[model samples]
Structures are given as structure tokens and as C-alpha cells.
Target chain A: MHTRTIEILVGLFLIAGVVAALALAINVSGLTGSNNGSYKVYAHFENIGGLTKKAEVTLAGVQIGTVTQISIDADLLVAKVEMEIFSEVNYLSIDSSVQILTAGLLGGKYIGLSVGAEDEVLVEGSIIEDSQSALVLEELIGKFLFDKVSE
Target chain B: MNISNKIMDGIASMGRGLLDNLAGLGRASMVLVHALFVWPQPKTSFSLVVKQLYNVGVKSLLIIVVSGLFIGMVLGLQGYTILVDFGSEQSVGQMVALSLVRELAPVVTALLFAGRAGSALTAEIGLMKATEQLASLEMIGVDPLRRIVAPRLWAGFISMPILSMIFAIVGVYGGALVSIEWLGVFSGSYWSVMQGAVDFYDDILNGVIKAVVFGFAITWIAVYQGLESVPTSEGISQSTTRTVVYSSLIILALDFVLTALMFGDV
Candidate 1:
């Protein structure tokens, strides 16, 4: 009887470890976005440079949302990115810049939000005005080569 | 003349000792093969395996978790210090996750298992031998090898991977705590960077395979030492010490080989 009790306890401990590992895996994978008190926003860019769905959206280094969708504009040949911004970050102005940025030198792409001096706060379903795409390494290299060749 | 004779004698004894140890290993392997393949009763082996699993895996949980956490914290702190100079502190997540999943988790988990459970198993078996319990079992026509050693060996094989997984997972969290909360990194960055950087097959699955291999080495060494140890108190102590030393050396060496094979091209 005593050994059986001990076995049960050990089994419970092992189960807890597994559950914690699973929870951590899910959290780190970013499967569940910032669903806590968030609203939608959108932006347009020339090139996203391998940005995928569910990329983080940050305002002043704080995560405020995620990129929910990416689509190409039919006429302007621009990438239209849809974002979900949490309502807690309500201080963003209508003219705030939305820029695609790499987290580190070779890290994943995310959205960086820069504040503007305008007084009117951004509303739901609004578009950020100043949008910047990621800097493409190949484009820069090609441009450098073209300049060098011309010279 | 006397001094030369002593030197010659010492060399001769050393050779004899080496031969004796090799012979012991041969006998132990025979026992292992029988224990593993020649199943007498499946129910008894299964129950014994569970008991050994509890002893080796569950009892060592606290130490594994604590060490895993500290290892991760150190990785985060040190990684940040180095990476911030390059303006890449954000990549600490990748550094920590990759380090833990690919190398530290399996290596550290096996080391701890050897030190704690491996040493204990060795001592326990050595004690049983010293007390002549094994002889008694043999006289009773019971195959002590199957009854005693096999389940423990199989248990270690199973436990090492699970423990290493838990270690890596816990270590990642420890890294996140330091990188995110203490260092003021974005929480999202801590996890997202890791998820993007680590591959399921290359980083995680390979780490698991390494864990299984380390487990087999450690357990086999411990059990072999215990069973073959000279039937004395000094012998038991010596075997226990040898188990720790040999298992650790084997774990580190195997890590290098596995890493070369798994990630040599990349």
C-alpha cells in the first residue's frame, strides 16, 4: 500500500513535468497571439523581405500586436499587412510609422511602431501613415554593384 | 637489483590488472545480453522497470530542474553580455535555446544522472554483491542478472531522454526569465526568436537521440561496475567512484561525436 502511494506521487510529478513542457512549447511557438484586449490595424509596404504571418508588432520595444495577414495590392504592387494592436497602446497617433524590422542581425521580421507628434489618437481599423519595408540585402548589394560598374 | 625487481613486478601487476578488468567486462556483457534478451517473465520485468524508473528518474527531478534553471540563467546572462556588444542581445533566445537543446541539456542531464542515480545503482549492486545476496539468488536457481540488472538498464535508457527534454524545456524558461524579466527584453522576442531559430528535427530530435545514447552508456557502466566489483567495502566504493568518472567522460566524448555527425555540415 505504501509503495503504491509513492508510485502515484511520482507519476503525478512526471505528468506535471510533461504538462509544463507542452505549455512552454506552445507559448514559445507564438501560436496564440496577443488576444488580450487588442484591435486591428493595417499598413502598406513595398517589400516585406520574408516576413511571415503572426509576426510580432511592437511599439517602443513593447509587444502591442501581431501581423495577422499579408496580401499584395492589385494596382500599386505593394504588400498590405494587417495587424492586431492591443487597446492598451491607445496613445499611438494616426501618423505613427509602421516599419518592418529584423529583431536582430539575422532574426525574424517584426513590425516596429514609431510615435508621431500628432494629438489625435489612432482609432480601430485605421492605417499607419509612414510605412517602411525591411532592407533587402540583395537589393543593396545589386545597387552597390551597379554604381561601381557605372563608375 | 631489488629496486629493478620491484619496477618489473609493478609493470607486471599493471598488465594483469588491465587484463582482469577486461575479463570482468566480458563477463558483465554476457550477463547483460542474457538479462536483456532472455526474458523469463514479462510482468516481473515491467514492474521492476517502473520501480527503477521512479528511483532513477523521479527522485532526480529536483536536482535536474534546479540545475537546468541555473544553466539557462547563466547562458542568458553571459550570452547577453557577449551579444549586446554586437547589437544582437535579441538573439540570446536563439543562443540559449540552441545551446540547451543541442548540447547542454543532454550533456548536463546525463552528467547529473550519472552522479546521482548512476552512482547509487552502482553502490546498491556492489552492496548486494558484498553481502553475497547475488550468490544466494544463484543458488536458488534464480537468474539474478535478469532479475536485478536488466530493468535498471532499460529504465535508464527510457529516463534519460525524458529527463533531457524536461531539462531543455525548463532551461529555456529559465533563459526567458533572465532575458525577458531581468534584462528587459521583449517577452515576445524571447519566445518567438527561439521558435524561429530552432528546428524540430535538427535541434530537438537529435538532442533526444543523444540523450538515449548517453543513458545507455551511463546505466550500463554503473551496473557493470557494481556487478563486477570485488566483494568488499573498498571495492564497492572504488566501483561507485569509477562509475561517475567513466560515465561523465563517456557522455562528453559521445557528445562530440554526435554533434559532429548531426551538425557537421551546418
Candidate 2:
């Protein structure tokens, strides 16, 4: 009876290990899949300090895709962001504008897109127009403090 | 001599003792590595390594799994509560995953394994020494360090990585289940949060390295204490206690060093 009990325990442990392994593999695959042939769009930002790779790009606060890569263009001195938008959200028009947004007053940065009602849909490699740069928290705080000093 | 002179003399003596111990430790480590490579015949030790892996890694799975689940759940609950105050419940997945992958899973699982298996190893080896089995092996020209200690060391190192991987996965699952299933977190946002939270190679490699270091410490301390045991039963018991205490301390110290080295400015 004791031997059987030990065997059962060992079996349960093995199952747990297998389940855990599968979960991790699934999560990893999910991340990799997020970078597939999902269409890319570029947004220029003056500052994107808290903005990171894989940060969600949301339409109406609903995630349409994620920021894949970010690089500063030396000539423009602007941060150019590459995003992967899902095929389902391909209805975004070429006149659509992108904004770097925050969840709240002290929240991580995300991309916000304002949909334009133009008949034309955005091409895969098009740049988002009417873009707003990231709202730097420290600069905003400094501005607020500076206003108080001047007043 | 004056009191100040006596104090200086004592300080000088302590410094010499520290240097002497360090030299001895350096030589001993070199010998241990040499013995590990040369003494164990691959033909015979292959099966031994497999058995030890099963005993060390597979055997401790349950405790690690259960502990990991609870740890994840706790992290989710606490993180949700704090994040919700700021109305950011969606970020709970990222917070939970980051904590589990980077810190909690590896350290907690290693400590748990050390408490369980490390104690058992110390006692088993101490008892064998008390019974003079080690001496008998020595008389027969059997290198006990290679045969017994090496297997335990290898077992511990392998077990730690396996257990850590288990812990990280289970913890993430537990967090996801609690937040998404129990609470009303959106499936879309939960996944989005997790995407930013985990890096495949970075997190896994960190966990594996921490586990390997932990395993080495546990087994090394256990075997060192066991080998130093006297024939008396009391001495054996004392050795076992010292082994567990020292191993636990070393594990914590090494965890800090490894974390700093792996992820700077921790």
C-alpha cells in the first residue's frame, strides 16, 4: 500500500512538470507569434523614454498590435517606431494618426490610434500621420512645478 | 604586552588564518574538479548520474509545484490589489510573470529543495560515516568523493534547473488562472501584458544558472560536513545541522551574487 502510494505521488509530480513545461512553451510561442507577418506602421516620437519594444498599440484602448522596434532617425532627430498590427485591424485608414499614450497619470506607455474615416485603408509599410510624441512624466512634472514657481 | 598590542597580534593571527583557509579551499576545489573528471568511469557513472537525477530532480517536483502555485497566486493577489488602486489591473500579468521569472521561482524553489534534500543528504552521509562505512570504503581503495559526493553534486545541479523551470511555469499559470478565470481580466489584455514581461532566453538562462549554483552549494556543504563527522552519534547529528545551516546561508549569498551578475543594478 505504501509503495503504491509513493508511485501515485511520483506520477502526479511528473504530470505537474509536463503541464508546467507546456504552459511555458505556449506563452513563448505566443510572444514569437506576435511578431509574424503582421503589417508594420511607423510613428515618429520626440521622446519615448518609457515606451519599449512590444508595448501595445491600441485602437480605442483595445490592443490592435505591438511596437516591434524603435530607432532614432539622425536626420529627423525623431524616434521612429515600427509596429506590427494584426490583419483583423487592417481597416485603419492612411489618414489615421498615432499618439503615444499612457494608461493613467503614472502608467506605462502605449500607442493610441485615432481612426480616420477615409475610404482608403493603410498600406502594410505606410507611416502613420498626425502622430503625437510620448508624454514625458518628468518633463510634465517639471512644467507643472515651473508653472507654480512663475505664479 | 599592552592591550593595544594584544589586539593587533590577534588581528594579524586572524588574517593569517583566513589566508591559510583560502589556500586550502583553492587546492581542495582543484582536487575535487580533477577527481570529478578523472575518477568516475563514464561507463559505470552514466547510470549513477541518471539515478541521482531522478532521485534529486524528479523526487522534489511536487513540493516545488505546490509552492510555485501558491507563490504565483500570492503575487497576483498582491499585485492586483496594488495595481487596482491605480486602476491598472491589466498589468497584473506582466508583474506576476516578471517577479516569478526573475526572482521568486528560482530562489524559493532552491531554498525548498535545500531544506528537503540537503538535510537528507547530510544525515545519510553522516550516518554512514558514524557507522565507519566511509572508512571501510577507504580501506578498500574506493574513492568515496568520486562515487558518492560527485553523484550528489551532479544530481543537485540538474535538479535545481528542472525545479526552477517548473516553478516559473506553474507560477505564471497560477497567476493567469487566478486573474483571468477568477477575476474578470480581459483575455486580450492579459496576453498583451505577458508579452512584454517575459524574455525567453534571458529568464530561462537566469533560472538555470541560479539553480546550478544552488545545487552545487547544497551538495558541497552536505558532503563536506558528512566527511568531517566523527564516529559519535552526536557528532553525526551536529554535522548534519551544520551542513544544512551552512548550505542555506551559502545559497542566499550566491543568489545575490548571481542575480547582480545576471541582471545588473538589482
Candidate 3:
């Protein structure tokens, strides 16, 4: 029984360690912004590969905000991605574009927003005119492999 | 019989055995369900859980920690070798972190725990049955399932994630150390790449959830096999072997399922 008590205490510490790790992982991104009232915007994509709710959403090569939600729009037949951008970042002009881009070959995809030279800023509810979906690397690899075989 | 006939007979016998085991599994599930409802009071069950926690968690820590260090070092070495091909050897940190958090840490830690704590749980319970201790408990109005099995289950479920986290942390550190000192990568650049590669919550939650599922599978199979032990010593030994094998198989299967559910959205 005495040995059992010691073991149980050790077990609790193990659990605590796991919980600590998870907490650190969740809060560790280290990307924080000044208190700017950033408005919400939604982007529609066919597929946002491996992009989870807390994924980073960037504009003009700079991370502006994070993905707030990802849901399927039944009426529109598309993936609706909601993102929150800081209000102070003024680079998102009217003609700016959003593209789902990969970090590297096997890394997670993030929304990459490129700025347009337009003078007017995109207001809330204004959709970015042009967007590109993620390129499925596996599919591309398969195509290349098959093409080589056929050739 | 001739060779072909003998082979066919063996296959048929194996199939029959599998079917019989499936039927037995169904019966065991029923027994488990019955045991759950008729279990003893909450206080006793809690104590059982406490006892299990000690056995599974505390006793397993040192092994988990040492395992973590070696896994980390290997991951670092392997990742550096590949990254060097692309002149991106500094990316070893990220590679080590991703590999450990995403796959190796959870799997290795679970395997270790299953081989150690899981086998022990099965053997102990099997021995109890073989010695009629389980029956004796019942005779004294003690509900063995709630007291003995439930705690072990809870202990396993709790310990797996904890052990996995320790493994990942240690592994990443080990990888970084090897990459810097042995591989001669610039420490600053290596760490920077790792810093960029890992996002705290996104990467960390993946391991935690995987560990929890692993814990549940290891304990459940171990305790279940143990509780179902026959009276003979041979029966007890057989159950112990089965518990270890089945627990490992279940762990791998669960890893696939969880990975698909969690990361397959891409």
C-alpha cells in the first residue's frame, strides 16, 4: 500500500507534465499584437489542406491574424474560412489577393495575402477579388510518376 | 494427410479459432457491462484508481525520460543527415520537434509502457485469478472489477500522455544537442528554424490527444485479458502474452485512427 501511494503521486506528476506541455504548445506561438480592433473577414476556398481553426492567416508576407473558424458552406458548396486581422495593418488594399500557400514541402498551409497597389483599403465584408486554392502535392507527385512511366 | 491437405486443415482450424475468440470477446464485453453497473461504492473505486495511478505513472517515469533522450538524439541525427542533403541542416530542430511530437514520442512511450506496466497489470491480475484471490475477494463482498480493474484503466489513460510529453521534450532537446555539438550546425540557426517550425498549441495538442488514446487502449486490453484469466498457471501466462501483443496492435490501430481524425483534414 505504501509503495502504491508513491507510485500514484508519480503518476499525477506525469499527467501534470502532459497538461503543461499542451498548455505551452497552445500558447507558445508568441505572436501578439497591440490592442487594435481588427475586424473579421471571411474567405471561401475549395480546400484548405491541413489548415485548422487556429492556423495563421497572413497578408502581404506578414501575419496579420489567425484563422478563427473553418466550416463548410452547404449553400455555396465551398469552405468558408473566417479570419481576424488587426485593424492597424493597412496593407490590405481593395485588389489584394488571398492564396493558400504551403510553408514548405510537408509543412502546414497558411493563407498568404498579397497586396495590390489600390489606394482604398478593403472594408469589412469586402471580399478579396482573386484567390488561389492549395496545390495538392501528392496529386502532383502521382501525376509526375505516372507521366514518367507512360513516357 | 498430404502436404496440401494438411495446410488446408491448419488454415481452417485457425479460422475457427479466430471466430471462437470473437464470440468470446462478445461474452467478455457483456461481463464488463454487467460489472460496471454492479461495481462497489465510489470511495473504493477512487482508491483503486489512486493505486493504479501509482503503479502506472510514477513507476514508469524514469524509463520514459531515458527513452525520450535516446529517441531525440536519433531523430536529430537522422533529420540532420537528410536536411544536409538540401543544405538545410539547421532545420534539424524543426524536424526533430515535428517527428517527436507528431509520431515517435507517443508511439515509443506507449510501447515502453505497454511492455512494462501493461504486462505487469496482466500478469498480476492473471496470478490473482490463478491463485483464486479474485474469487476470494468476491466471497468477501468486494467488487473486484471496480476496485481492481477500473483503477488500472484510469491509471493507464492518465499516464500515457504524461509519458509521451516527457519523451517529446527530451527528444527535441537531444536532437538539438546532437545537431549542434556533433553535427556542427550553428546553434542559433538551428534553434531559430525550430522556433519557426513549431506552433505551441497546434503541435502540442497532437501529442496529448494521441497519448490519451494510447493510454486507454493499453490499460483496457491489459486489464481485460488479466480479468479473463483461467485458473491454471499456463492460462495466466498465455493471457499475459496476449495482453502485450493485443495492446500493441490496438495502439498502432488507434494511432492510425486518431491521426486520420486529427490531421487528415488536409
Candidate 4:
């Protein structure tokens, strides 16, 4: 090839490579670039189990938000989860409930939200009133064995 | 010689060898520092860098893409077999994507770069030295390090991360092809789960960072070996071999350190 053609090819290669990197960042890795479309909501559970920050916060079966932070409510002795719900999902009633649920038999934990029937919808910084802690298998097994022994 | 005398001689030779290796390392590091810090003339350097990029990056693209595809497909197949037993066959996408983005793409691309481009660099520079071209350039008041080594080094450094990213992107698609198309996996869940699981900053960015580090080390080793080789055909061959061997070992060792620092819990 001519020197000019080779140089152009090289230039194209570099450009394509850079574009691929950007694609990986944006498309595959899901870099959304901003949090302006989301509002914060809080929920507290007695035990979160393996639920982690950034875990899916699903309404019905669709993901509507993510767990932004998890901390202890020192006074209440509960695990406080801060979620960023999409602003479009503004219909969650103040009485909406959240439950920690597993994806599969052996999968990550997520918070499933069940909307409530009420006139007052939850707003930014609203604390979900009804919440269920994650299921602990060992505790369930222990209870079952104890019940059987007692019987 | 007596037993003690022989033992003392062996100890003395071992110390001498250690000192020689340390001195060589110091020299190699100096070569890297100089190549990095010294600025070559831009008007000419840009063209030089482009040419070297073509030689190193463009030439190596086919191997990178092919290997990436096969590796991803293999991961998909293996992950499906394992996760299927657990009744989470849909997670094959997540497994393939995570493995490629977090570890395989960068590491494998770097290893291939060392073998394909790094050895070639060593041999090319060694040949130039053998033919007295470097010395001739020096005699003409040209800085050979700035003119020759710096551009090649920069080209290698730039090419590696780009190659690795392409590898990862292609690999993800390859995995998708196997899982969603051929294996009867739900396409939506396959992609959605992968997107949910792989974080840009934690997984993709860290992988890119690993690629960048590997590039810098591999190029530095290749150029240093070339520059330090004896000016003979056999010496050039030896330097090329050393470039591949040393680069591979350094890449693996540095990968462990980088992974620990980047991903390990304190």
C-alpha cells in the first residue's frame, strides 16, 4: 500500500479502537452518566442478609431503581437501605412495602417493592413503612428441627 | 580444590551474577525513563508513531479478534454446563462478560502482544543495531533513543489498551451469540443480567487500567532488550526470545499485584 493509504488505515484503526472503548464503557458496562432522573427513598429492615449496595430495586418484575447505600440505623438497630428510584416511578404510595428477595436459589439479593393503594404517594426522602427482612435458611432449618424434636 | 574452597567460589559467582542482573535492570529502567520523558520532534514523530502503530497494532488485530471470540464461546459453553445444573443457565452471559471484562481480555491480549509485537520490536531494533544504523544515526547528531525507541514504545503503549478493549467487546458479543442464539437462552435476560452485573468503573475501567499497565511494561521490556542486545545475528535472536519470555513473566507478576491493589478488600 501507499504510505498515505497506510497512514489513513492506521488513523482509522486508532479511531475505531477508541470508539470501541467508549462503547464498552457506555453500552456493556452501563455508564448512565447522571443520577438526575432518580429520587431517593429509604427503607429499613431487621436483617438485609447478603443484599448489597447497587442491588436491584424492582417494582413488580421490572427494575425501577438501585440501592445507593446501606447503613445501620443505630437507634432502631436495623439495616437502613437508601434507594434511588426513577422519578417516573412517583406513584409508590407512602404505604408501599419492600421485601428482600433472592433472584434464584443461588443468586444475588434484591429489594422487591409492592405498591400500596393510597392517595398520598411517596416523595423524595420518604421512608418506606412496610419492609420484610431477608430469609435466613439456617434460622428456618433450626426452627424446623426444634419443632420436630418438640413434637 | 577442597570442599570449602569450591563452596566459596560458587557463592562468589552467585553474588556476581546477582549484581550483574541488578545492573541490567537498572539500565532497562533508565531506557524506559528516557524514552518516556524525552520528547521527540512532533512533526516527524507523529508519522513515525503512526507507522509503528500500523506495524504493531493493526497487524495484530486479526489474532486478537479471533482469540477473543473463541475464548468467549468456550467460557459460555463451560459456564452453561455448570450453571445449568444449578438451574441458572441464564447466568452464562454474566459469567462470560465478567470473566472477559475483568480478567481474560486484558491478560490474554497482553500476552499475545508480547509474543507478536514485542518479539518483533526486539528483533527489528536488534537488527538495526547489528547493521550500525543506530550508531550512524548517533554520528549524524540524531538522538536515536528519541527518534527510534520513543515512537515504538509510545505506539505499543497506545495500542495495547485499545486492542484489549476491542477483544473484550468482541468477546461479549461472541458469548451472546452462543448463549442467546444457539443455546436457547432468553436474549433479554442474557443481556440484561450481564448489564446489571458488570459495573463500568469496577470491572471495565479496572480492566482497561490493567491493559494500560501491561502495555507500558511490555513495550519497555521489548525496547530495553533490543537496545542492550549484542550486535550479532545470534544475539538478536536471543534478545527476541528474552523479550517474549521476560514480558510474559512480568505481565503475570504485575497482573497479580495490580489485581490485588485494585480489587482486593482491605
Candidate 5:
């Protein structure tokens, strides 16, 4: 091939490679726009049960936000989970319930939200009052065995 | 000869071999430092780098794409089978994507590059040496290191990360083809879950770093072997083989260290 043609092809190749890297970053890894236009809300749980930061915060089986931080509330002796809810989801009632739930049988943990009937709406820095801690399978099994022995 | 004399001779030869290997390593490091640190004339080197990029990067695209696709398809098929037992077939996407982006793309691409471009580089420069072209260039006031070696080295450095990214992107889609099309995996979950699982900084960027490092090491070894060859046909063949072998070993070793540093908790 001609030198000019080769140079053009090489240029195209580089552009394509860069485009691929961008796709991997944006499309595959979901790198951008993750926390944009989002408001923070806190929920306290007795046990988080392997719930990690960046885990999905879903409502009605659709993701609405992500878990931003998980920390221990020393005063309450509970897990204080911080979530970034999208600005579009600004209608969550103050009394809305959040539960730490697992996906599938052996999948990741996420926070599931159920809207409540209330006039007040949750805003930034609002604490979600109604929260259910994640179920520890080992505890449940242990309780079941103890009940069996008692019986 | 007595047994003691034979034992001493064996130990002396082994020590000599080790010393020779160490000297070779030191020389190779010097060549790499010179090639990288000493900037060539930018006016003419642009075209040289472009030419080398065409030869190294564009020529190697076919094998990378084909291998990436096949490897991803196989991963999908195998991952599905294993995950099906756990009733987590939807995770096949994550499995394939994570493996390809984090490990397979960089590692496998480097191995293939060592075999394909690395050996070719060794042989080409070895031939140039054998034909006294490099020597003739030196006599004519042209620095062969600046004109030839530097361009090829830069080409290799630039090509590797690009090639690895292409390999990963192609592989992910190939995996999707098999999992979503063939195995009846839900397409939405396959992609969404993968996106959720793969971290841009931890996985993709780290993988790119690995690719760049591998590129530098492989190209450095190739050119060094070529320049140091005995300037004969037999010597050229030996150097080519050594280039491939050494590149592969170094890639694997460096990969382990990089992975530990990038991914390990420690």
C-alpha cells in the first residue's frame, strides 16, 4: 500500500481505539453522570449484611440512585447508609420505607424503597425514618435450628 | 578428570552463565533508557513513527480482533455453564466482562504481540544488522537508534494499549452475542449488571496501565535482542526465538506484580 494510505489507516485505527476506550469507560463501566443532579438521603439500619457503597438504590424494581456511603452511626449504634437519589425522584414521601434486599439467590445487595402515602416530600439531607435491616441468613438458620431443638 | 574437578567446572560454568545473563540484562536496560529518554528529531521522526505504527498496530489488528471474539465467546459459553449451576446465569456478562477487562485483554494481547510483532521486530532488525544497513546508516551520519529503534519502540508503546482496548471492546460484544443470542440470557440484565460490576478506575484503567507496561517491556526486549544478535542468519533466528520467549515470561511476571499492586488489598 501507498505511504499516504498507510498513514490514513493508522490514523483511523488510533481514532477507533480511542473511541473504544471511551465506550468502555462510559457504556460498560458507567463512569460518567453517576452522581450528577442527585440529592443525598440517609437511612439507618441495624445490619447492612454485605451492602456495599455504589450498590443500587431501587424503587419499584427500577434503579433510582446509588449508595454513596455506608458508615456506623456511633450514637444510634446502627449502620448509617447514605444514598444519592436522582433529582427526578424528588417526590419520595418522608415516611417512605427503605429495605436492604438481595438480588436473586446469590447476588448483590441493594436498597429497595417503597413509597408511602404522605403529604411531606423527602429533601436533601433528610433522614429516611422507616428502614428495615438486611436479613442475615445464618441468623435465620440458627433461629430455626434453636426453635427445632426447643420443640 | 576427578569428581572434584568436574564439580568445580560445573559450578564455574553455571556462575559464568549467570554473570553473562546479568550483563545482558544491564545492557538491555541501558538501551531502553537511551531509547526512551533521548528524544529524536521531531521533524522526520513523526513519519517514521507513523510508518512503524502501521506495520506494528494496523497489521496486528486482525489477530487481536479474531482472538478476542473467540475468547469472549468461549468465556460466555463456559461461564454460563458454571453459573447455571448456581442459578446465576445472568452473571455471565459480569464474568466475561470482568475477566476480559481486568486480565485477559491485556495479558493475552501482550502474549500475541510478543509472538507476532515482537519476533518480527527482532528478525527485521537482525536482518538489517546482518546486511550492514544499520552500520551503513551510522557511517552516513544517521543515528540508527534515533531513526529506527526509537520509532519502533514508540510504535510498540502506542499500539499496545490501543490494541488491548479494541480487544476488550470486541470481546465484550462477542460475549454478548453468545450469552444474549445463543444462551437466551436477558440482554438488559447482561449489560446493566456488567456496567454495575465493572469499576472504571479499578478495572479498565488498571488494565490499560498493564497494557502500556507490557508494550514497553516487549518492544524493549525485541529491539535489544535484534541489536545484540550475531549478525548472521543463524544468530538472527536464535534472537527471534529468544525475543518471543523472553517477552512472554516477562509479561507474565510483570502482570503478576501489577495485578497484586492494582487489585490486591495489601
Candidate 6:
């Protein structure tokens, strides 16, 4: 092969590798440019247990949105979570119940949605009623210990 | 000889063969390191290395792209089913990214590199030796190690990591295409969840490091096996096959060792 051709080939190879690496690195970590067609919903919990921002909100085991914000209700002294559900899921009923459920034995916490028997549809910024707090492992262990001690 | 004597003789020969393999491993490692020290001693080495970079890295692009896309798509589909059970199918990006960066990219790229570039290197050097071209160069006082082996070895060492990274990057895009476009996942959740979970230094850098190490090991075996083989057509062919076999085994074993050291809890 000619020296010039070899140089061009090497340059192309290097460029391809660099671009791919950059793409891969970008894909793995940093700000997600995934803000496409998502709308917000609200749910309140008494104890969120290790739940943080960007958790999942699902209906019937299917992901419909993300937990975009978390804050405190000053009067209720409880946690409030804001979710960004996709616009396509237009019929999440207002009477739907949200629960803070853990995945597997040691997986992350997410909000699970179960639709209630109601004809009303939830528009943007609507609040989900009948939400439950996260099932804290520490609390479960403590309660178990107390029950054993008393027995 | 009696049956008992024959059994004893078989055991003795096995022990001797084991010793020979150990000795060969020691000798091959020494020669590889020696070539590394002599790598920069030649004026013509740069152009040759570039040629090898094109030969190995550029030529392998299509294979890498095709396989990377398929691997990513498969992971996305499979991970969706499992993650859906956990109500976290949106995190399919995390599953694909972590799996590709930490394992599949390096290991698969290295295996392919061995079969493509590594086998060819062995065949090329073996042919040159079989035809007495190496002997002619040595007769004129030109060192074959500097002229022939060093450039190819170094080129492979550099190219492996780059190819692996490209595979990983392309793979992530493939996964995104499947999970987001095909499966109707929320587009934003895919990339963002991946970003939230994967670590840069812990996962990506370690994968690149593994590729570089695998490159050095595979290329060293290829070049050494070819350069030192008996100067015959059959001998050359046998050594080329051995290059692929040995590189595959060593790549897998070294991956285990490196993973234990780099990602182990200790």
C-alpha cells in the first residue's frame, strides 16, 4: 500500500475510534438529553425511604414516566414526589394509587401506579391520591426485633 | 514393555510437555518485552506501524459495527423483559451501557481481532520465514525484530483499545434505538437513567485498559508464534492456527485475572 493511503486509513481509523469512545462515554454518564414529550404529575408520601429524584413511575409494571422532583410538604411534614409521565399515556385516572415499592431484594426504589375504578382522567399537574410510603427495611427489621423481644 | 511401564512412560511424557510449555511461555514473554524496548529503534518503523493500523483497525470496522449493533439490540430486548418485572424498563439504557463497557466490547473485540489480525500476522510472518526472506534480511545485517515484528505488535496494541471503544459507543446507540424507538420507552428516561447509574472511571476506563492488555497479549503471541516456527509451509500453517487458539485462551484467562484485580471488592 502507498504511504499516503496508509496514513489516510490510519487517520480514519483513529477518528472513528475517538468518535465512538466519545459517544460511549457520553451515553454512560452525564445529563440525559431525554426531555422528549414528558409531562409532570404529583404524588405525596409520608416516608420515601431512599427514593431520590429521577426514579421511575409505572402503571401495571410498564414505565410511563420519571420522578422529576422531590420536596417536603411543610404542613403535613411528609415527602412529595413530582413525576414526568409521557404525554402518550393520556388516561392515568385521578383515583390511581401510587406506592413506593422496591425492586427485587436490594434494587432501587420506584413509584408503582395502580389505576382505581374511576371514569375521570388526570390532566397535566393533577395529583394522584391514595399513595403509600416506601417500605423501609430498617423499619421492618426494627419491628421484627420488637415483636421477638416482646414474645 | 509391560502395561505398567507404558502408563509410567505416558505420565513422564505429560510432565515433560508441561515443563516445555512453561518454558515456552517464559521465553515468549521475555522476547515480547525485549521487542517493546527495541520498538522505537528503527527509522522505517513508523510507516510500517501505520500500514498495520490500517490493516487491523480500519479493516475490522464493518465487523465491529455490525456485531456491536446486534449485541446492543439483543441486550436491550432481553433486559427489557427482566427490567419490566422490576417496573424499571426505562433503565434499559443502564443495562446495555454497563454490560457493553465493562465486558462485551473488550472481550468480543479481542476475540475478533485475534481471528482477523492476529491470524493474519502469524500467516504473514510465517510465510516470510518459510520463504527465507527473514534469513536474507539477517544475512544483510538488518534486524527482523525491528523491521518486521515491532511495528505490527505496537500497531495491534494501539488499535485494540480504539476498536473496543467504538464497539461500546455504537452498541449504546443500538440499544437506545431498540428500547426507545422500537419498544416505546420514554426517550429521556433511557439516556438519563444510564447517566445516573454508570461511572466513567470505574466502568469505561477499565474496559479500555482491558482491551489494551488483550491487544498486547494477542499480538505478542501471534508474532512470536510465527517468527519462531519451523521454516516450512505446513509448519507456517500450523503456527497460524495455534496463534488463534492460544490468543483466545489467553484473552479469556487474562480477562478473569484483570477483572478480579480491577473490579474486585478487595
Better candidate by lDDT, 4 or 6 = 4
The top-ranked prediction according to TM-score is: 5
Candidate closest to the true structure, highest lDDT = 5
Clash pairs, model 2 backbone: none
Q: How badly does each model clash, as a count of residue pairs?
A: 0, 0, 8, 0, 0, 1
* Residues B1-266 of candidate 3: C-alpha lDDT, one tens digit per residue: 59999999999999999998998788767645665556456777766666777778777888988888888899888888888877667668778888888888888899899998999999998898888888899999977776677667767887788788877877777887799999898775565456556666566678778888888778777888888877688888888899889888988988899888877985
**Model 3 superposed RMSD (Cα):** 8.6
lDDT of 5 by residue, B1-266 (tens): 69999999999999999999999989988877777777667879999999999989999999999999999999999999999998889889899999999999999999999999999999999999999999999999988888889999999999999999999999999999999999999896788788889999999999999999999999999999999999999999999999999999999999999999999883
Candidate 6 residue pairs in backbone clash = A34-B188
Q: For candidate 6, lDDT tens digit of each residue in A1-151?
A: 6779879988988988887777766657554456668778888898999887767787887778878799998888888889989899988777999999886565678789998888897778888879999887789999999999999
Per-residue alpha-carbon lDDT of candidate 4 for residues A62-137, written as tens digits (9 for 90 to 100):
8898898999999999999999999999888999999999987987789999998898998999999899999999
Give me the displacement of residue B85 in model 3, in angstroms.
2.8
Per DockQ, what order, best first? 5, 4, 6, 2, 1, 3
Clashing pairs in 5: none
Per-residue lDDT over A1-151 for candidate 1, one digit per residue giving the tens place of the 0 to 100 score? 3679667866876686577446545644434443668788889999999898778888787778778799998988899999988788898888899888887675678889998999998877898769998899999999999999999
Poorly placed runs, candidate 1 (over 4 Å): A20-25, A28-100, A104-151, B1-25
- Regions of candidate 4 where Cα sits further than 4 Å from its true position: A74-76, A87-95, A119-123, A142-151, B1-19, B187-199
TM-score of chain A of each: 0.77, 0.75, 0.67, 0.87, 0.86, 0.76
Q: Local error of candidate 4 at B216, Å?
A: 2.0
True contacts kept of each: 0.27, 0.21, 0.36, 0.61, 0.73, 0.73
lDDT leaderboard ranking:
5, 4, 6, 1, 2, 3
On DockQ, the stronger of 2 and 3 is 2
For model 4, what is the alpha-carbon lDDT of residue B6?
95
For model 1, what is the error of residue B75's alpha carbon versus the real structure, in angstroms, after optimal superposition?
1.2
Give the C-alpha miss distance for residue B146 in model 6, angstroms. 0.7
lDDT of 2 by residue, B1-266 (tens): 69999999999999999998887577657645854676568876766666666666777877988999999888878888888888889888888888887788778887888778887787787888888887789899987777777787777766676688799988887888888888877777777778676776676567667877787777777766676667688888888788778877887898888888888863
Q: CA lDDT, every prediction?
A: 0.86, 0.78, 0.77, 0.90, 0.93, 0.86
| lDDT tens digits by residue: candidate 6, B1-266 | 69999999999999999999999889888777777787374557777788888888888888988999999999999999888887778779889998999999999999999999999999999999989998999999988887888888889999999999988988888888899999987787788778767777888899999999999989999999998788888898899899999999999999999999988974
State which candidate, 3 or 4, has the greater DockQ: 4
Return the lDDT, model 4, position B121.
Answer: 95
